[model samples]
Target: MSRLRIHRFAFLGDARPFGDREVIAEPREALEPRVRLGERPTDGLQAERHFAADEIGDGHGQAGIERRRGGRVHGGASISAHARARPGRAQKSAIPDNPRRKRGGIVEVPFRLRFAFAMNLSLYVVTVLIWGTTWIAIKWQLGSVPPPVSIAWRFWLAAAAMFVLLRAMRRPILPPRDAWRFLVAQGFALFCLNFLCFYYSEQVVPSGLVAVVFSTAPLLNSINGRLFMGRPLRQSAIAGALLGLAGIGCLFWQQMAGHVDDRATWIGLAIALAGTMCFSAGNLLSSRMQAMGLHPLATNGWAMLIGATILTAGSIAAGLPLAPDTSPRYLAALVYLAVPGSVIGFTAYLTLVGRIGPERAAYCTVLFPIVALAVSTVFEGYRWSPVAVAGLMLVVAGNLVAFDLTRRFFVRTA
Candidate 1:
């Protein structure tokens, strides 16, 4: 490095040393030193001299460059002086070191994080299987039991189990004051009313049929969202929705043509439709509750408790059948319904809502019917007619269309 000695020059007037013996002009008169350096060139001359001598620049020089002219270098001195240093051409730091950088720009998580996500995802799969299988189990259980009795028993048992589990974990069963109303409403919709209609429908209609009816919930939500919440449907959403409805219409037509004379079956189908509407409405309710800062599990627990109480009271008041010769098989089914179906399923589903959002997670409804059909075939000897098979294919196609999966397939083909 070539070293340069700079002399005090009043004519140069508060200039910075550039190359050997050259003083760069002070940015402007605004940057003129308060004290005239001509009278006492040697006064602050020490600072300038030291700065000129030092390869590592001094504070004033740095300050002169930074503040007055965009300084590019600074010496290790006082902070104020360091602050004045030339704003060094910022070295491109490591991504983690960058302050203004965005996340989601990189795959930052390690394999360990990916493995953890996979485990959580596996738990979700277990939840789905449990939920799907229980639909058939629920149908079987409802065969002999009154709908309210069965619903009440399932929830009471679940609440008991949850209470025990919570006690073990030292978690509180009682919620805070503000949450009671939401919990009650949630309970009514999710537990009492939803299950009441579903179980009653399943008693008359096939479980697989109930599953198909429930699959239309997203389509219902689309309408509900548009009407109540003023969410405008995109053209793609509209087109997909129409296609899905057309598919459902094909299935409905097959069912009606095959079994049009069964009034009881039609009643059951009507009840199932009502139950599904309630279920879809609950989605919006749950979303609202979440926005109000309630945890889904806590809301569900409270709601289940309220639902159980209401159903029990309603059963007694209506002089409905209470006991159903509860066998071990029935009891085991109830346990499964309460724990895995009600608790684990809701927990996993709500978590999924938080992760991927409500709309995307609801795609589970499409898959759920397929699961129900498969389970029914195995357990209940549900033989699919040729028409039924065609209906099933339509349902699958509808779901693909609704979810834009078929759109991608077509794009790829094209």
Candidate 2:
């Protein structure tokens, strides 16, 4: 019987044999054999090949020796270990796949979710800015043309623009027959009466004041939602409503005190309040239309056309001159209001209402006033007295309270 010589060697950190005792090798003088006495098949050749590759260029070094100790490679290296081992390659592969890890810590937001959050935020900021600056443009449309005719021309251009856009995009122009009734109602409330009231109100009051009054839409929306949609009116909403009302009273108190006998101020206030209610009603209608599977852009296109038609017919009947304003300023303002204000602003806002419930989305009403007031300060000479500043703060506070953002802020701080 031939005597078998068994050899054992420590593979860096692993204390194990690399080969089986089944294959007996002739004692070679070239390299020392580090073999274990075992019946398992030897992985010595494979280990030698891996070790040679590691020493030459692979750079795994002693780690590769430990990996092949038990006749197979182990895959228990942590992310940090892999990153440290292959800094460049591991960084490229690991961080993006596990978006949870950043700067050596786990953050846990997936790439797609982060992208969607950014998109929603962008839409929100765009909507607020467009609607905010739009009030000043409405002021420019006041002269030469009656509010009805100006409103008519505005929506007609918007409708034409939207229709052309829809055609170019290959989107359907007409809605379902059942949606027509809702569309008509939406046309009347949103595009027709709401704007009519706002334009007339701006004629009597400053456009900024009109915008301030319109800020009450969220409160009205909460009420309408409770009445029509059977949604509960939370205590925060009621508190917000009270604060908003008090702020409005504060805003108008000076005007009322100075000119108690002026009836036009009262009328403007009433009209603005009515317009806000109309806007809130339209919000509910839009929510209903979306629930019925209608896209806001499509519904808005048809509704704007219908509204323009009605306003045009009413302007003709009332004997208001239906001619377009020829002045450069008026024309430019009209185009801006039609395209960005009506088309883009309304679409973005209603889209938000559809995505995040109307109550939360209506916070745009609160934010728009700040932008409007800033523009008013620059263009309309809207001086900010301490009283006006306090009223504005109260309005902002109301928004924070209603949205539960105030509570969230305190919790974060705590």
Q: Candidate 1 on 180-287: residue-level lDDT in tens?
A: 776777688877788889877877886546656776776776677567654445444445445544454444454445555788878998999999887766775665
- All candidates: CA RMSD (Å): 20.1, 21.2
TM-score, structure 1 vs. true: 0.63
| TM-score for each predicted model, relative to the true structure | 0.63, 0.68
Question: Stretches of candidate 1 above 4 Å error?
Answer: 1-124, 167-173, 206-209, 229-256, 261-265, 379-414
Q: Candidate 2, residues 1-414: lDDT per residue as tens digits? A: 111122211112122322221111111111233332122225332211111211111111122122222223233221223223331221122213354333233223344334544555566789989988887777687777788988888899898888888899787778889998988998998899998897787777754466567767767877888898755566776676567656655654565465445688778979999988888888878777765556678888888998999999998999888888899989999999999999999888886665444665676777676787688789779778788778778877876676566775777631
lDDT of each prediction vs. the true structure?
A: 0.55, 0.63
Clashing pairs in 2: 7-35, 100-107, 100-108
- Which residue pairs clash within candidate 1? 65-71, 66-71, 71-86, 71-87, 72-86, 73-86, 187-303
Deviation in Å, model 2, residue 200 alpha carbon: 1.8
Q: For model 1, where is the 10-residue window of minimal lDDT? A: 53-62
